[model samples]
Target: MSAARDWLFADIGGTHVRLCRWGRENGAGDIVRMRADASAGVADALLGFERAQTQPAAHAALAIALPVRRGPLRMTNRDWILDPESLRATLRLRTLCVVNDFVAAAAGVPVLGERDSLVLREGVPGPGSRLLIGPGTGLGVAALIGTTGGDERVLASEAGHMGLAWQGAEIDALHGLGRTRWGRLSWERLLSGEGLGWLHAWRSGAATPAPAPEVASRAAQGERAAREATQWFSRLLGAFAGDLCLAFGADAGVWLTGGVLDGLAETFDAAAFLEAFDDKGRYAATQREVPVRRVLAGDLAFRGLARIVDGACRAPMLRLSAATTHRHRN
Candidate 1:
C-alpha cells in the first residue's frame, strides 16, 4: 500500500471513455480518450493500454455513470453491462473498484483547490452534507455526508429518473411538450444536452432538432428562440437543484459538473439560476445560504480515483451480486 504503486484509472461515460495510468511517484500519467463503442468491451480497451505500459497495473479504479447496486449493473445510457469478476479475471488485477461517477466527483470536493472550481454563490457551508448535480449524456446526483474530523462519505443516486415537478407555467409548458414524446418527463429529459435540443424544438416548434452546443452558439448569434430555450433550461436546472437541496438536507453546498453546463459557461444566466434556485418559499433563506459552484477540474474524478487508490478516501468496496451475470460483446 504505497503511493508509488502502479494503478489504472478509467472514467467511462456513454459517449467517451477516459483512461490513464498512475505511477508510484509522479502521480497520473498522460490521460487518453477512446470512443465507448458498444462493440468493444472495456476489458479489451484496458488491455490495449496495458500493452503500452511497462507493466500491468495491480489495481484499477473505475467510475461509470450507472447504478452499481444489487444485481447486474446495467448502464443507463448504453447497452454495455459490466461484471467485476469478469473484469478482474480478464485484466489480472488484484483489486477493482467501480463507483458511481457522481460519487467519484463528490470525492474530489475536499481535494479541490480554488483553481479547480468557479464559485457561483459565496455562502459558508453548514456541517450537514454537500450535494452534486450534473447533466452530461445523462443527469448525475450524489451526496457527501459530513462527519467528524472533516471526513465525508459519498452516496450515489439515480435521481434523473425522478418525476419532474412543477416550477412555473414555463416548466409546465415544457413538460407538456416533452411528455408528448417521453410519456413521463424527468429532469434529465429537459436538462441535458439532448434535452436542450428538445427544449429548443419545443420552443421554436421546429421539426428539425439541433444539438445543444449548436443551440448555444446560435443563441450567442442572437437566435431568439435558442436564447429563450437556453434560459428556460437554466431556470429548470435551478429549480431542480433547489429541490435536491431540500431532499438531501445538503445545507453545506452544491457543485455543478458535466459538459453541458460547461458548454453553457458563456451564455448561461447565472442570475436566473440563482433566482430559481432560491425561490423555495419557506426554505428560501436556507437555500440562499447554501453555496453553489461549478467544478473547473476536468480530471476531478480521476483525482478521486487516485485518492481511492491512495486510501485517502473511503469509497465503497466493489460488490458483486451472488447472481452476477457477465456479458461480453465481440
Candidate 2:
C-alpha cells in the first residue's frame, strides 16, 4: 500500500460510533472525528461517514466495535451487518480490513509512546503480552500477544458477558435491592459508563433520570451519591480488570481506557485498585508487577487502526524471517 493513500479509520462501540481520516503516522497522528452517534448499527453509523466524505481511491482499514471477518460482520451490541466488499465497491476503495474494536484499541497501545500512557504503577513491561479493557457504552476487553520475533497479535474477548459474581455484602446488596429489578448482575452491570449511573441511582435511591456522562459529571462537580457510586464502579472495574490480567498473563501491563475511566477519578485510586487486583493470593505479587494505566487522547483509535494495518502488512516479513531462521538452524 502506498503511504500517501489516506486510510479511513473508525471506532464503533455500544454507545458511540466514530469515523475519521488518516493524518500522520498512517494513524498514529491526528484524526478528524466525522461523527459520533449511538451504535444502532453499522449501516446507520457509516452513513454518517458516507454523507460527509466521498470514497477514497485506496484501501480503507476499518476498526469496529464488533468482531469482523473479511466479508459480513455482525455486531454483538447491535444488529448492524458490515460487508467490506459492498462498502468498498460503494466507496470505490481498492481494499478493506475489519478489526475488532478492542483489538484496534490494543494496537494503538504500543504506538501510544510515553505521552499517551498514564502510569498507575512502576513495572518493567516488555511486550510479552498486554491487556486492554475499558468501559464506555460497554465493557470492552482485548489482549496483545507478542511473537518471539516481536510481532504483536491482538486477541478480542467477550469477557463482559461473564456473569458478575458479587460476593458477601455485594451479594446482600443485590438481594436487598431486588435482583429482579437489576436484570441479572453481569460484570457490565456495574462496570460501564451507563452502569455507573445505574449504580448511583440504585445506591442513592435517587429517582432522577440522566445519562452516565451526566452522572459522572455531576459526581465530579461534588455530588455525594455520585461519588459513592463511582467508588463502587472503581472497585468492580479493578476486580474485572485484574481477572483479565490473570487470564492473559499480560506481563506487559493492563490498560484501562475509554471515557468511563477518564470521567471517574475514583477508578484512578491505585491503592484501592491494586488492593482488590492483588487479592489473588499466591499470584498476587506477580500480578502486582503488571502496571495499570488509562489511555488519554482522542486520536488513539485512529493510531490503533494504523497499527493494525502496519502489523498486518509486516506479518509476512516476520514469518519469512522465522522460516529463514529454521532453514539456517537445520
Candidate 3:
C-alpha cells in the first residue's frame, strides 16, 4: 500500500469512534471501533489508530459529530476538542478533510440500496430535497439538495437545538419538567439516548432516571411507564421530523438513522410514529404523502467518507491561511 494512494477515514461520534482505511484498488477495509473516551482527545485517538496500522495513510477525511467551522472543533455531547491543522501535522497527512457527521451521512443517501433502508411510510418520490435526521447521544439534521446538473449539495444544520413545539397537555407538562431540569428545552433534550432516560424518569415519577438501554429493556418487558415513555419518544420524533420536512420542503423523502432508533427496532411502533408525522393540520395529507424510511445500514458515515476519498463526493478540505488561521471551502 503506497502512502500517497491509501486514505484513512474516521467517523467520530459522541460515544464511539470508528476508523477505517480505504484504497483505490481495494476500497474500504474493515472498521475498527473504539470508545470515544478511551483516548485523551481526537488527535490521540487518530494517532493511536495510525500507530497500530502496518503503514500510515497519506490522506485522511473525518466525519465528526459537531459543527465543522473554520478553526478548532468542539463536540456538542462529548468533551473532545479537535484542531485539524495540529492533527494534520501530527499524522503527517498530505491532505485532510473534516465535515459534519450528518453531512457525511446524508452523502450516503444517494447510494442506498433496497437493503439499506426500510420504508416507514410510502409516498411519491419527487425531485425535491431529501432530509436526513437521526437521534443518538444527540440529534442530527442534514439536507441533500439535488442540482439541475445532477450533482448534489449537502447542507449541515444544528436544527436539533431548536425549541421543541408541544401541542397537548401531557407534552406541555413534559416540556415544563425538561425546562426545570435543563434550564432550556431543545428537541435533543427529549430525542437523544440521555433524553429517553430523562423522559422515562419524568413519566414514571422516579427520583432517578434509568439508562436508555435499561428503559428500552423495561419497555420490551411490558413495563407500563417505560412503554409509555418509549411510545411518547417515537411520537415526538415523528412530530419533529415532520416539522423539519416542511421547513426544508423535503418532498423527496425522509431518511432516519441513529443508535437510539436502532436499539428500539424491536419495539418501535411505526404506525404511531407515522400518525404523529402526518398530523400537520391542513398539510396532513401532504405530509402523509411524503416518503419516510429508516436506514438499516450500519457504519453509514464511513461509507460516506469513502465516497469523499474516492472523489465521488466533494467535501470541503481544511486549509491554513498565511495568517495561520484555518479556512474551508463551501
Candidate 4:
C-alpha cells in the first residue's frame, strides 16, 4: 500500500500571504515545500501551482484572519474580501478547509511546545480555559474550548472591537484618542496599530505622521517622546492581558501574538508588565494566578490548519478517488 499524498496550506496575514505544499518524502514523516506568496489579492499568486505538470492534490487548507460564513468574507483590518467557494473551485482541491486565523493559531498550541513560547507568569492558570489575544494591524482573540464530543475547538472572538476598558489615566487617553476621529472610545481605539500611533501622539503632545512606520522608527532611535509612547503601548498591553485572564477565568493563562508584539518585545519588560496586569483592583490575586505567554511561532496558524484538514499533515486520506495517484519510488 502506498502512503503518500500532497496537502496544501497557507497563512494570510494583514500585510502578506504565504502558501506552501506538504507531503511525505520517504514514507515516514511529512515535509513542506518552500513557502510561496499568494499575495494580498492583487493578482492570483497560484498561477505557477496551476500550471505545474503534476496533477494537483486532493485536499488543501487556508487559514485567514477573516470571517468565513459562506459567501463573502471581508477582513476586519484589510481590503481583501475572499469568496471561499470561488477560491476552492479555482484551486480545484477536493477538500479546502477555511478557518479563522486565531482559531488556527489556537489549534496549533498543542504542537507548538515550549521553545515557541515565552513565559510571563509563574502560577497555575486554574480551571479556566486558555485565551489568545493579539494586537497588531488589528486585534485578534480566541478561546480554546474543550468540546463535549471529546475534541477541542478554537472559538474566534470580536472582543477586540468590544469596547475600550477605561480606568484611571487610560480614560483621559482614550477620550483624547476618540475625539481625534470619533465621539466615543472603542477597544480598537487604543489596541491597534493606528491606535498605538494615536497614543504615542497624545502622550508626546505632538502630531502623528501619516504612516505608523515612522512612529516605530523614532522610538527605536531613542527619542524620549517616542520611547514614552512605546512604554504606554506596553502598559496597555499588560492591562488588557489582565482583563482577558479575568473574563475567561483563564487561570490557564493567555497568549500574545502577531507582528506588533514581535517589534515591541524589547520595549516591554514581562515582569513589569505582569505587575500592571495584577494591579487590577480586587482581582489582584486572580491576576497573579494567570500567566502571559507570547506566541512567537509564526507558522502556528498554518500548521493548525493542516491539522484540521487531517489528524496529521499526511494522515490517511478521507477522500480518495481512482485518480488519487499514489506515486511510488523504486
Candidate 5:
C-alpha cells in the first residue's frame, strides 16, 4: 500500500461529486465539489481533477452512491455505467478502491467528534450495531458493528429499496401516485429528494412538481401544503428509521446525515419525527432506548474516504467481470 498522501478520494452521489487529496498526517486537503455529470461518466470527472493538480495521484478511492459489485455497474439515479478495470486503466491508477457511499459514511461515524453531531434523543448505549442512514439525491443505509477485539466492521445495505412500512389512506394515495409515475413504490420513492417533491405535489395537488429545495423553502415560509409535505416526510423518515433499528438491532445509536435533511434543518419536525420513531407498538420502549443524532458536518463521506486510504478502514477494491465488460467513458 502507498502512503495516503499519494491518493485521491472521491464521493460520487446522484447530484454531486466531492473530491479531495488526503494524508494520514494532515487529514484531507481542500475539497472540490461539482455537480455530477452522469452523461460524461465518472472517469472524465476524475481526469479533469487530475489535470488540475501539479501531480496526479497514483491511487484513488471512490465512495459511490450506487451498489459496488464485481462486474460492470450501473448507477441507479444516474445514467453512467462503470467498469472498474476501465476506470483504473483510464486513470493510470496503481490501486482503485470502490465502496458504497453509505459505507464510507458509516466508516466516518467513529471519527466524528462532539461538534460534528447533534443528539436528537438520548438513550442508553447497548452492545449492538450502530446504524447510519441519510437522504440526498437518493437514500443511503449502512450498519457499523464493533467486535470485542476493538476492530469495527461496516455492512452496506440497499435498505432504501425496501417496501414502505406505513399504512393509511394518505400512504395509499402516495403509493398510487408513485405507482402511476414510476411503476414501483419503495421506501426511497418517498424518502428522498424526488420523494419530497412528490409528496409536495400530492399535498398541494399541483400539476407540476416543485423541487425538493423549493418545497423546503416554502415549508420554512409556512406554506400549508409544503409544511404538511415536509412534516409527513419527517414522520415517515422516523418510522422507517425505527423499523431499521429493530431489524438491525442497532441499539448502539443511529446517525442521520444527508443533504436533504440538512436543508430541512429549520423546517424538520423533530417532535413529529421522534413521536413516529418511538411509535412502535410492542417495541416502543426499545425504540426510545436507541439514541438518535443528526450529523452536523457535510464532509462525512470525504472523511471516511480519508480513513480508508489511511488504512483505518478496509474497503473492497472494485472488481470487473471479463464477461460483463462495458466502456463507461467515451
Candidate 6:
C-alpha cells in the first residue's frame, strides 16, 4: 500500500481559520478559509476538512493566535477556547503540535518569496535575529534566531502586551485615553482593528464606533477624520515596531504582518511610518540600518506549520514548552 502521506496544517486567528493539506509531493493544497465565530466548532471544521482525504492525516500542526503555554487556550481577541487533549482525541491524530501563530510566521521567513513581501526599508539583513510582528485581532510577536549552521529557531513572545510607548503630545493624549479607559494599555490596544476603531472614535467624536475596514474605506473617499486616524495608526505602529526591533536586537530585519496592515498596504503612509520607525533618538542610526518589510503571503502561519510537520524546522515541545514560556510579561 502507498504510504499514508497526508498532513494537516491550520492557522487559527481571531477572525478566520485557514486550513491546508500537505501532500506526498510536498505541496500544499488550496487554503480553506473559514470564519472563526461563535457558531464554528473547531472540531467540526477539522472533521469537515478531513472527510476529503483518502486516509487520515498522520500528523497535524496548528498555529494559533493566542499564547500556547498549555492546554485550554483562550484567544486574546475572540470568544473561542481550545483544549489540546480534546482536539487530539476528536481529530484522531497520532501527533498534534500547537504553537503560537507568530512562531510559525517566523519559521516561514526562510521561504518567503520575493513577491511575497514589500520592502519598506532596504537595509541588508545581518547574520543575526529577524523579527516578526503582526497586528490582527491582537498583536503577535516572535523572533527567528539564526545559527552558525544556517538553521533558525523561532522564539515566541507576548511583546504585544508591552506598554504602549511613543513620543509627541498627540500620541500622549491617545495614551491618556487608553489608560483612562483600560487602566493599562499595551501595544495591542492601539495597533489592532479594535484600536483603529477607538482611534477613529477619538478623532471623529463619533458616538457609535465603526469597524476598521469601514474607516479605511472612508479614508479612501477623502474623509479627513478617517484619513488622519489611519495616518496616526500607521505612524504609531511604526514607532512600536521600532521599539520591538531594538528590544529584540533584530538587526537582520523586521517583518510586519496581520490583516490590519495588509488591508492598509496601498493606502498606509509608508513614508510617515518610516519616519517614526527611524526616530529613535541616539539609536536612530542603528534603527535606520534595520530593514522593515510587510509580509504579503496569505496563510503564512499555515505554511510554517507545514514546515514543522515536514521536519524542515525544529520540532516544538508541544504543550509543555507553551506552558513554560506562555506568560505575556515584557
Alpha carbon lDDT at 58, candidate 6: 67
lDDT of each: 0.80, 0.66, 0.84, 0.64, 0.83, 0.78
Please give the TM-score that candidate 5 achieves against the real structure: 0.93
Tell me the deviation in Å of residue 138 in model 6.
1.0
lDDT of 1 by residue, 1-330 (tens): 465547888888877788898865878888988888833766777887789887788878788878765445778887778877788778877767788887787878878889888999988788778888998889989887866234657777788889888645755766676668778899888888898898888778888678989988888888888888888888888989999999999888899998888887767877788889999999998899999998989898888777755666666646332344322110
Q: In candidate 2, what are the lDDT values of residues 121-197, reduced to their tens digit?
A: 87767556788888877788887777533655677787887878554476466544446766566787667766787
lDDT of 5 by residue, 59-112 (tens): 788899788877777888998887778888888777777888998888889888
Order the candidates by lDDT, highest first.
3, 5, 1, 6, 2, 4
What C-alpha lDDT, on a 0 to 100 scale, does residue 292 get in candidate 1? 93
Error of 1 at 63 (Å): 0.3
Query: How many clashes in candidate 6?
Result: 2
Distance from true location, Cα of 248 in model 3, Å? 0.9
Q: List the residue pairs that clash in candidate 6.
A: 69-322, 69-323
lDDT of 4 by residue, 1-330 (tens): 124446666666676566666554422123233322434461264444445526565566666777556556787766778765566667676656667777777777657678898886657756567788877777777777553234566666677776676477655755765766687777666666777678677767766532355666777788776677677777777777777767776777688887666766666546556776888888897788786788877777766665655543221112322344221110
Q: Which regions of candidate 5 are displaced past 4 Å?
A: 1-4, 147-149, 315-330
Which candidate do you rate higher for lDDT, 1 or 6? 1
Clashing pairs in 2: none
- Span of ten consecutive residues with least summed lDDT in model 4: 313-322
lDDT for residue 120 in candidate 5, whole number 0-100: 91
Clashing pairs in 5: none
Model 1 residue-pair collision total = 1
Rank ordering of all candidates by TM-score, starting from the highest: 3, 5, 6, 1, 2, 4
Q: Per-candidate TM vs. native?
A: 0.91, 0.82, 0.94, 0.82, 0.93, 0.91
Colliding pairs, model 4:
125-251, 125-252
lDDT of model 3 at residue 163?
A: 90
Off by over 4 Å in 3: 1-5, 147-149, 314-326
